[model samples]
Target: MIGFMPMLSKELRELGSSLKILYIPIVFTLLTIMQPVTLKMLPTLLKDASNLPEGTIIQIPDPSVIDVMGSLLPKFGSLGSIIIILIIMGEIAGERASGVMAMVFAKPISYVGYFAAKLIAGSLLVIVSLFAGMIISSYYTEIMFDKVDWLDAMLGTLLYVPYILMTVAITLCCSAFMKSQVGAGGVAFVLYLVLTMVPQYLGSFFRKVSPSHLVDTASNVIMGVADTHIVAPLVGTLVLCSVFIAAGMLLLRRQEV
Candidate 1:
């Protein structure tokens, strides 16, 4: 792990210089806040946009604060995943292409350190952005609906972090071995779909154990459901993240860069 801290600082500096530090949080915040705002305004929006006959009424009920908060994870899961892939898909592949990897490796850094730095930096960016968005969205949800429990919101967000971490690990793993950034992004996206979606068809057990299940667990947490079933999905997600990080490091070490 030689030069790990310096390497991490470099990665974070690059992210800031690239303005990902500015826009990612904004995008995620918008993605999260939109859920509650749209839900709150749905009835009015529908009524205004409709071409219905005169005196026709759209009577959609407003969602509760719990429901609004519970809906955030699914929104983040789909769009936020794509945003993460786009941001990290080029982290390794682009460096390798531009000969930056060779320059960086010329230092006393171990491949493990380099890989770990990338993983941590990317994960930090996404995790911070997610929490920023969640906090702001929670505030808006409370304002538009009812009061939200801070403890529940924070715990639910914490539970959802593993999914985001797994996303970074998978993207970096693809970037480490693939020569093309676009190819890495595509493959990562496909793998993301497979990992999140395929388990459902396999069995209830698989579905419950998959990383995607963590989103459901987080949603349940926000909704105040008292289930002890969170352990499997949480452990499964962390283990999956470790497997990908190890694989990425192994693949990176084999490369000429």
Candidate 2:
């Protein structure tokens, strides 16, 4: 196995210069634009009542920067989820299919170094994208709501980072496992769907350990709307990441050269 430092450095250079890495910044940029537009439009959205009493008076909420984050963050995060999973899937499965995996294997680099670089790099890409979206969303939210505070928005976004990391680990495992981009993408999506809807269909008690639960809980925690009630998710995410990476490495070692 190649030394850790050189392997990591080499992997970083490969990832940094790749076209696939463009997915992160592009996805993030789109979300950034979407946030403000969605927040700015929410008030008009809520005001449109499908059915209301003739004399009823409904108060329309003026969109605020926080509202943008509140409404858009979760949704944007979901979108980012797709991009992250696809990117990871491509990094792992696509490379194997396209022969990049074989080339990497020929080098002196450890499998651990190769996969770890992608995992970390992918996470950083997600972070940058999320951060950009937050900034754009906040700027627009403030314009609409007139209650935007810079500090609150910044702090809230800071609280969002761990959740992103957790997501990276979650998807990365799937990517490493499937060795096919489509398969990894499908796995992540299915997990996301179950997590996203279970709380509404079932009771809230299941939120503790659910991956979907973690995403929602973390968002709420950041916004100060709810207490930090989903500690299980945080712990589960770490476990999930470790498990995925371990499985990926084990598989890598066993793959026929």
Candidate 3:
């Protein structure tokens, strides 16, 4: 953990300088807000559709506030994950390519500090962005649709944090191992897909334990239908994140850079 604080401060400073602190939250806010906005406007948009038949009777039902709030996680699960991959793909690989990592290592920083700094910085950016987006979206949904439980909204979003953290961990792990940023991104994206998709088809137990299941669990929490199986996936996702971080540190230690 030598140089952990300095490395973390450096990472945070770099994040601010790169404008990632500004744009990432803006993107998350837009993505989350779009859910309620679209739901609210669906009836009007469908009623005025140009492609519909002249006498078409569209009967779109208005979605409840719970349903609208529940929809936010899926959008984040898909597009938000991709955005994260793109943002972090080059963090290690690009730095290594430019010899920045080597230069940083020339200092007194330990591999744990270096890897943890990247992971924490990335996770902080994403989690803060998500919190901003969810809070604003919940406020907008309350105004546009109906009242929502603040406790449910915040708790649901908190439950989803581990999954997002795992994504950052996996991406950093990929970046640490690969020499090319594109290769790191591609591999991380594939691993993301596998971690999210393959478990459901494996078995019922696998589905319940998968990191992707947390998205559904979070949605259920928002909708007030959550079951007692929450701890399993939560712990499992955290363990998986630790595994990836350790893998990254190991891989990084073996490399020259």
Clashes of each: 0, 3, 0
lDDT per residue (tens digit) for residues 168-233 in model 1: 999999999999999999999999999999988998888888988999999989878786479999
Superposition TM-score, candidate 3 onto the true structure: 0.96
C-alpha RMSD of each candidate structure in angstroms: 1.0, 4.4, 1.3
Model 1 regions more than 4 Å off: none
* lDDT, candidate 3, 13-84, per-residue tens: 999999999999999999899989998998778777658867888787889998999999887687999999
- Candidate 2 per-residue lDDT, tens place, 11-114, comes to 56766687545656666767756756655565456567456556666565555444555655577667777777766666777777788777877878777776
Candidate 1, residue 123: the lDDT equals: 93
TM-score of each: 0.97, 0.76, 0.96
The Cα RMSD of model 1 versus the native structure comes to 1.0
Clashing pairs in 1: none
In model 3, which residue pairs have backbone atoms overlapping below 3 Å?
none
For candidate 1, what is the lDDT? Answer: 0.91
